[model samples]
Target: MTESPAHTLFSFGTLMDERVQTALFGRAVPTSPASLAGYTTRPLQITDPAVIAASGLDVHLILERRLGASVEGAVLHLTDRELAAADAYEVDDYTRRRVVLTSGESTWAYLDAKPLRPAERIVVVGDSIAYGRCDPQGGWAARLAAAHIAGNEARRRVFNLAIPGSTLADVSEQTPALLPARRPDTLLVAAGINDSAVPVGAGDGDVRPDPAHVDAGLDSLAATALRHGARLVVAGPTWLDEDRTRDYEGLRFTRARALALRASLRCWCEANHIDYLDMWEPLRGNGGLLADGLHPTAEGHRELYRHVRAVSC
Candidate 1:
């Protein structure tokens, strides 16, 4: 009598343990050294008592996609019954996936059951600061996009639609163009700096943006975003160097006005249950953060990128 055909299983971690094989299959299944392409291993915490006892370790390896990366493992040839037993041993966090190996062989392996979906698209709209006027890297939004959406290493697509000298009203105007024919993913607004600018030669009561108008603009943006299925994030304005800004291009930017706008934006975001990034404190008083009193330096842009990624991304 001839033996039945076998299923191929690729394992980079716990499944390769002889002790685990014996506990699950009653014998050590034969394995051949192999490598999985386009994936790298990450540590996963295992809580199943049986799995821990069988492998004698509480952590296991799972695969995540990384271009040009590879996971070293082995292929096990198992009979139908043994394969079924192997399936029973895996935890819920892992799901079997078909993959091509480095040696031009196809096989099955367990991967993260709930893998993170790559962000489809991200859109940024705001003022000159958002336009990355001074930062060599184009600003915080650009840096974040470059890290996530550029080249083969990219996991998503990012678009910066910010225009210099734009206000919250400008963002509202730009919103229509942002609505995707399909579905929109995320929209980040980084305005209010231009709005807060105090005209150097104007009267005491003349601030550039009317608070009421700012609120209306924000409301319009939020409503449009909700209707379009896009997640809205409002990144508040940072502080300016009052001394230097007092004479820049015949416009005076005051820290006091920036503070007030930041507070107002934060309140608006809170009232609407929206995400708001407060960038004032982190960038304030840092001599090197601001270039020419209004725009952020490269390091400042990096800082903004970090904070934006922490919440918005």
Candidate 2:
């Protein structure tokens, strides 16, 4: 693990935004009122939608070096990983510089410095199961994050991109664009169950996906991770109860599709040396594990979180 950062950073821009802070630091950054001499804050319009969505503003505060001017802001301490995430979050227009504060404390401040550093950030992408769509406490993803805090596992932090009803196609089509913005150190993807719900196989009436779909989608996902310099962890689809999905209308067929998706995912992960989690191996035949025959119950989320906890982000 990288050493925790001892450097304190002064924020004069979007880093002050709570959403941006959480996205970068994985926790609320501790801050205190501080001022910088010889600088002034200027409001600038940010055109990047990703930045706007994250910071919830189309305008950002920037510091301009000026004589006899003092800029008031907050002082914050961030881990090395958090610093890297912040660097990635800011656009190219900004740079980093060390400055002395009015309070006699010197800290790192973003100005216009060049950016590049290692990161330990993670993003979770998947459907309702990954989103904990039914669980009030936010399901397994939240639990996994909580576990990290309890264990002092600073090597990994998460940003959830999961959406209810998202399919592998959605992941393949959308993740490439989102990853660069999040710039996660790793991407843990849980999908394919919804895709398998579609018809497939040569039997009388099948709705499962063709193996080609899985292959193509996985290929795209893998490539997206590579493009962002992120490692990929592919988790198999969650186990399901037939009673919840159309009262076992096509139980065997759905099961087969799930199996095929898992098999293909397993093979791909193994061949690529990527980490893979098996929802089936752990939850199969476990009664009441699900909330609606589809999503996992809260207790079930705890179980899933335990599994996610094992993987090194």
The candidate maximizing lDDT is: 1
For candidate 2, give the lDDT of residue 13.
Answer: 67
| Candidate 1 Cα errors over 4 Å, as ranges | 1-119, 150-155, 181-183, 206-209, 246-249
Give the per-residue lDDT digits (tens) of candidate 1, residues 190-298. Answer: 8988778766776657433577877998998877765554556788987678776646567778777787788889888877656677877667888678887778888
TM-score of decoy 1: 0.59
**TM-score to true structure, per model:** 0.59, 0.56
Q: Please report how far candidate 2 places residue 21 from its true position, in Å.
A: 46
Q: For each candidate, what is the lDDT?
A: 0.75, 0.71
RMSD of 2: 16.9
Model 2 CA lDDT for position 40: 71
Candidate 2 global lDDT: 0.71
Q: Could you list the CA RMSD of all candidates, in the order they appear?
A: 13.9, 16.9
lDDT of 2 by residue, 13-45 (tens): 667777778876777887888988656767767
